[model samples]
Target: MRAVPRPAILGSIAAVLFLACVAPEDRGTDATNLRDPWAIRAEPGDPALAAGKEIFASCASCHLADAGGRSDGTIPRLAGQRAEILEWRLRGLQDGSIDLPVMTPFARALTEAEIRQVSAYLASLPRPERIGSASGGVNERGAKLYHDRCRSCHSAEADAVAASNAPRLCGQHEAYLLRRLEDMASGNAGGAGAARAVDPAMEAIAIALSMEDRLRVSRYLARSECD
Candidate 1:
């Protein structure tokens, strides 16, 4: 067996200790005090957009300059995501409802206005023409699964309102989708310190699907084109 490097072990220990020291209540921003994210928009040439671009620099390290995320699906693409959704998730991370370790600290550092600015900046970016995928081949079974189970909420129509705040799944990374499905099925979708309740309907759907079916669906969604 390969021995772990001392520096790597020490770094991991430091990270764990840091997270442990930060109490959920003490972490950061108040979600309730935030303004309506949907109401905020940063158009091109706006000062807010410029500020947002600066703020987004911190995020680019993980999400990438193009916000395309990693092909391995460790991260989710931020480009072309709805500002409303982005703000919502950021608020969730800030308030300890979402609980992503890497994101929580960053989200907590931002003020409500900063969140709006960054969300708008990311939304302004174009969606990736080529999204990350785990496999090259399309799964026909996955297509059927998506059409039957997911199409209603994750509509392909440009004018369609997201049902139940369901995000655009098409063009997402397959591994990320699969991981989320597995987490939802196992009642572990949210990380530690998650105060907000998980959606019962989505959880139920995830639990109902077999592992193979989840993979199929994820693969299908990854290959799909966004309008």
Candidate 2:
């Protein structure tokens, strides 16, 4: 038997205590560690709106200058997203609730006002045309799955996206949709997961989806075009 040093034992104990006792907000200022220090608003106006447009230059790389996002489903479409949805997404990233590495740093860098402004700016963009690629095959099963489970909240039509708090899924990139569906089902989604589960009902829905079901529905939605 080996003797354990008292100092080493005490240090291990201290580390455990820190992990257990420290609040999430006190951790650090990185996107995954910091909490929103001010009230989060999404409405755009005056000085903040202008400032946000200026700040958006850094985000243009992946999101595009128009914030239309990539069509391959690798990056999500931010264009025409609701301000509230944007705010929630950014907040989740900032607070470590969402695990998007690319978004976390950008969200963390913003001030409270900047968050609001950026959200508003993104929300203000006109939605781009649906150009993402979809699998070539009959999607009737996937359509049925969506109608049976997802239609009530997400709706079948494009207009429903703007009216509801939920983001538009129809005609979105298939890969992106698949990723989100899988994340939600796996309890890794930000608000839609076990960690925050801000929408517990949504969590229930997500949890109920199997991997096959997610793929089917995502492919169907991704292939859809707005009429």
- Strongest candidate by lDDT: 1
In model 1, how many backbone clashes occur? 0
lDDT of 2 by residue, 1-227 (tens): 13322222111111111001122333333334333322234344667667667666666776677766566655666666556555645565567754445444555655667667776776666667654456766589889988898777666753233222355555666777777666656656533323442344655666788888778887887777644
lDDT of every model, 2 decimals: 0.61, 0.55
lDDT tens per residue, model 1, 77-152? 6677667666656666666655556555655666798767877887788877786566869788988887787666
Considering only N, C-alpha and C atoms within 3 Å, which residue pairs clash in candidate 1?
A: none
Runs in model 2 lying further than 4 Å from the true structure: 1-49, 91-109, 158-164, 190-194, 197-200, 225-227
TM-scores, all candidates, are: 0.73, 0.61
Give the per-residue Cα lDDT of candidate 1 at 69: 68
Query: Model 1 segments beyond 4 Å from truth?
Result: 1-40, 94-106, 156-163, 193-197
What pairs collide in candidate 2? none
